[model samples]
Target chain A: MKIAFTAKGTDWDSQMDPRFGRTEYILVYDDEKETFESFDNRDIENEAHGAGPKTSQKLFELGAQVLITGNGPGGNAATVLQKAGVKSFIGAGGMNVKEAYKAYKNNELKEF
Target chain B: MKEIVIISGKGGTGKTSYTASISVLAGKDAIVADCDVDAADMHLLMKPVVEKSENFYSGVVAEIDPDKCTNCGICTEKCRFNAIPVINDQHIISSLNCEGCGYCEKVCPVEAIQMNEMNVGDWYISNTKVDNTMVHARLGIGAENSGKLVAKVKNEAKQLAEETNKHYIIVDGSPGIGCPVVSSLSGANYVVLVTEPSVSGLHDLKRVYELVDKFNLKAGCIINKSDINPEVTNEILDFLKKESIEHIVSLPYNENFTKAMTNGQTIVEYDQGELRDAIVQSWEKVKELVEE
Candidate 1:
């Protein structure tokens, strides 16, 4: 399934990867043949608030089934994700992208 | 009679410290307005005991009543902001995405959508230890209408200055050239652009200076941590001269700034050092310019 991972707070960028530090959105697209593709949030700049709801909307538009991230979904952001039928998982910090997807697929993770 | 606004294009540029120190140095002769409504830190240093506080309601947010609603897709179609969505056979409104345009309520065929007033933030008028009227506010998290809240704070500060017959008002403005910054610069007599010596600092400073110039307000520049990168500092000074903007002062990199921040005080109050003197000199030049 296609998924999007959002980094929470400010410090994780230096910890995970320097490029991820300033990125507002990371898109993981899955194909029917079990292949994966990644896209950066910078690809979409025309939308309002840049990476807030528009990122999630773009992921939903791309048919992303799961979202992996480091921060808890709260405020209006959580509501938007819920409405879009996107499954959000929190506490995914320190985990590699592949491991996060594995845990999510096995239903070991909880929704935010 | 004149107002001076202090703003840094980026956060953590010691905008609040300089503003607080200027307020302290200016003493009772000036009224201070903390216009960084989103994350106002001036109060931490100013130590204002709020003499009066009032709730500010900017506008209404649309609320969806699930009980009275049909699982109508009409609301979603009508919403231009994508604020209304259909989930689990239920129609819901995302409060964060809602612009409070009231379009959702008007387009609801079943009358299930209603607009309710929300308390977005609070504004205050207080007495600081420096013996000046301090006006400030806090914007609710994920809240919109910060520009209006800033405008409200400035209006209150102006009113307070008038009531007390104070001639000058010092405003600590928010970062960036967004709506709140514009609101802070709307009626200002002068603007002090606080900048650092970093590349990003100069970039954002130029952006903010353009904004200040757009409003036709006279502006001056102060380079904080100028010694961190003297080459860049010199470049900034040259740019200032080329642009015909006044270079009020350049403060060297000093640990005293962080130390003062840790102690919840301004550099002037923390240590009577060269940094403090530079800030004082900058304030004096600003005073002279505003008076001119």
Candidate 2:
């Protein structure tokens, strides 16, 4: 399964972004391939409205089955994720991407 | 015909009051368009009797047929606005959250979803006590597309002005620099920027003025309640001078404005004093500037 984290940078040491829709980067970790890929989310910064829905669509299209972030998606995005069957965990603010993944393994993150 | 829009960067800056008084001064020669559809209060002062009215439809919302639905979750997943939800094993569409994008209808596998045009508001052409035509609208609660409604009111007023050979169309615009305000500024010959002497008043004035400047519209400033804060008033004057915004009038704070509102009369009708005289002079200046 692939896991996605909203991050501030493209690396494992980058801090987890506290915002879902306006996150700077979306880092996906592939468990099977043991590889990390980052997608820039700066385009969403200029979105006048429906940023949450657009970000949710990105996650859906990226085929990320699990989402780990500081803040969960808003109502509109939440509906999309729920219907897409993606499990989400939040409350990872202040932690780096690697640390957040470790916390997820330890069940320290809250399910959103 | 010339269209003069009266807008305040912030609410309660006396935009509507000035519009009402000016309408009284203009009498039958000018028509009024109340473009503040969100919280339309011009009718309270104008006391317009509806001469003609029509329902305004804008945008569309999705509706699901329960009988045709195959309990498929595809529509819910495809809806970007989170408008569709499963209730008792049946997917239902919520009208309020729907953006009327019609994506759900397009993506519905069994053709269970249909897009319906939404009735957002109603527009009216009325006869006011001042012996003039007034075009206004009432937006539905929690409705979107107020900007479209404003456009409808302005168009109706413009057509009325042209047919009647009126010289001016006075528009009372919405507060802030949002979509409705932008719609109000479009195609307007002149803008009357009403403001107060408070800190936030000056800040929001600059913000709204930026929008007006972007539209390249000529604007004049009316400093209402100028005596409340002399320091801020001076700051406003300096900024206006720097921007070369014509200073049309400075009106002192008065309780009679409130009293006149409670009595359902314009300040020009209620006051025989300095406030009335200043508004009259300001209206004269506006007529001269808009004509030029």
Candidate 3:
């Protein structure tokens, strides 16, 4: 299983980015591989509409079974991710990607 | 044919009501286009009978093939929107999240992604209670490219006008100075911006006016509910005078406008008093101005 977290930096220790659609980077962790990968997401800044949906699509493509973020998955975006069978959590805000992942694994975060 | 669009920067300033009344007074010689696809309340007043309806596609989205699976993650890295998420050991693309940038398609190491266009909304051709036809639409929620939809609506209306040999196209436009509003403004011969007598109305009016000025379209103003605040009405008049915006008409506050709507009728059909007269007079003025 793979989990994705919106992040401010391209590393495991990067702070959690609050914005799901406009987050600076997305940090994904593969549980079986025990690997961490990150990608810059600065291109979302020019998106005028459906940013959340596009980002959710990215999560679906990234193989994220669970998503941890500060804000959303807005109403439209939540529907998209829901259809793709991806569950999203909204807690673990202000935590680094690693800490957020730990909280998510512990079931300490709130589902959105 | 002359195209006239009625726009308001703020909502609830009588845009649909006024457009309905103008269509009534303009008779069958006019083609009314309701470009307010965002809310689309003009149909409520005009009570159009459906003549034709069709789906509209604004843009294409990227789709992924899980069969040719190489988990190289190049598409994920190439996507700026973070739209590629892998699920259940199979990687897929979110059509909703895909901006259709086509960057991922080029970078996909295994040639997994393909771009596809999908229907995002519906457009309609309907016969109205006023003996004319209306071209309107309903944009799908989460639909992108509303500007393109607006253009489609206007183009249909213009085509209808030519087919019927109608000399007028009265467009009830969407609020704000966004892409839809800009789309409605394009190729229009006249723009009537409806605003009310309120602080926020004036502020939004200034914004809408700036857009009109930018386009350099021939413009006018209709101050609806002008009696609600005498001070604001005076200020609006003064501002228009200074800015050289034609004061098309100032309509007094009347519950009859709301009552007319509740009965599913335009004020011209429902009432005989001041509000109806004011709208009729405004339409006449618009016609004279257009003829000039």
Candidate 4:
């Protein structure tokens, strides 16, 4: 399964340290091999709450099955995600990337 | 006779706080309008007790009367917006997605589709504690026609200002440079762009500025929480200088702002300290500039 982590960062450097939309990083996890890769969501690099549906759609298009983020999707965006069949894990704050993936694998996170 | 709109390119940029504080300082001298029809918070700060309100209707929504209709999907085929959907054994129109284009009604073979007006929101004229009339509104959840609501609020504000012989009309504009913002800026004398000292702040500021310039309106900038990152603050200052946009003030990142908000008081009222003084000074300068 290809899972995408929608973090509040733009790059790997800032992705390691989460600060909401100020940082820039979207980690794509390939669950079959238990490995993860990251990409820079340049579109949301400087946006406040940049991990909104627009960026989330990009992640979905990149083949992400699961999205991990701090804030829940907005009303309109949530509808779009439901239509797109993308599962979102909201309120996963302060959890490191590896830990979040582990929780998802263990079916510990609830979908929004 | 000047209208100054306070707007932040993004939400939660303290636009309502600045508008409410300025409204207090300009007490009885201006007509205040909260034009942020979507997620309006100015009324929270202004504490306006609604003196009068009226239900506003945008366009008519098409409602299908299944009792009179056949199972034909003619109405669904004609709707370009895809508002019509087949559910259970009846064809239904989703009211939220309906643009009120009347295409479904026009194409209804059995004439079962009827356009019914729905209340989109409520517009109000209220009395605030500062002895001024405030025009604000609440747009219903999933409601369309926010531009219409914003226009109504601004029109009511202007009417009140003219009737009361007010010198200024202060508006708390919505975030983003969308239809509501356009409606709010229409016929405004000046605009105050409230922004933070962040990369996203500057980016959105430029986007909104472009929209304001498209309307040929004069605007100034205020850097809220300028102390968060001095490097980004300087970068913003340099950009403002390049664009010849006047930097009205640089507000430090102060916890008092949140505290004042929690207490439902303007910063000027909550703390008449240094930050309030700075805001007051900026308002004075803004008044002077707009008057010129």
DockQ of each: 0.01, 0.01, 0.01, 0.01
Candidate 3: what lDDT? 0.82
> If you assessed candidate 2 against the hidden native complex, which CAPRI class would it receive?
incorrect
User: Which structure among the candidates has the greatest TM-score?
Assistant: 2
Each prediction's RMSD over C-alphas, in Å, is 19.7, 16.8, 19.5, 18.6
Over B78-125, each residue of candidate 4 has an lDDT whose tens digit, in order, gives 888889889997899898789888988888788998998778889899
Question: How far in Å is the alpha carbon of B103 misplaced in model 3?
Answer: 1.7
Candidate 1 lDDT over B1-292, as tens digits, reads 6678999888877788889999989889999999887778888888999999998776678998888998767878988898987777787988888888898788788999899877878889999988888998877888763555776787678768878899889999988877567667755678898899999999888888877764455789989988899888988998899888899988888899889888988789998867877888888899999876
Clashing pairs in 1: B1-B167
- Native contacts present in each candidate (fraction): 0.00, 0.00, 0.00, 0.00
Q: Please write out the lDDT profile of model 4 over residues A23-110, one tens digit for every residue.
A: 2467777779877677766544222122345665776687877776543454445666677777877444446666666677788776
lDDT of 4 at B117: 76
Runs of candidate 3 with Cα error greater than 4 angstroms are A1-112
| Candidate number of the best lDDT | 2
lDDT of 3 at A79: 89
lDDT (0 to 1) per candidate: 0.74, 0.85, 0.82, 0.76
Between candidates 1 and 3, name the one with more favorable TM-score: 3
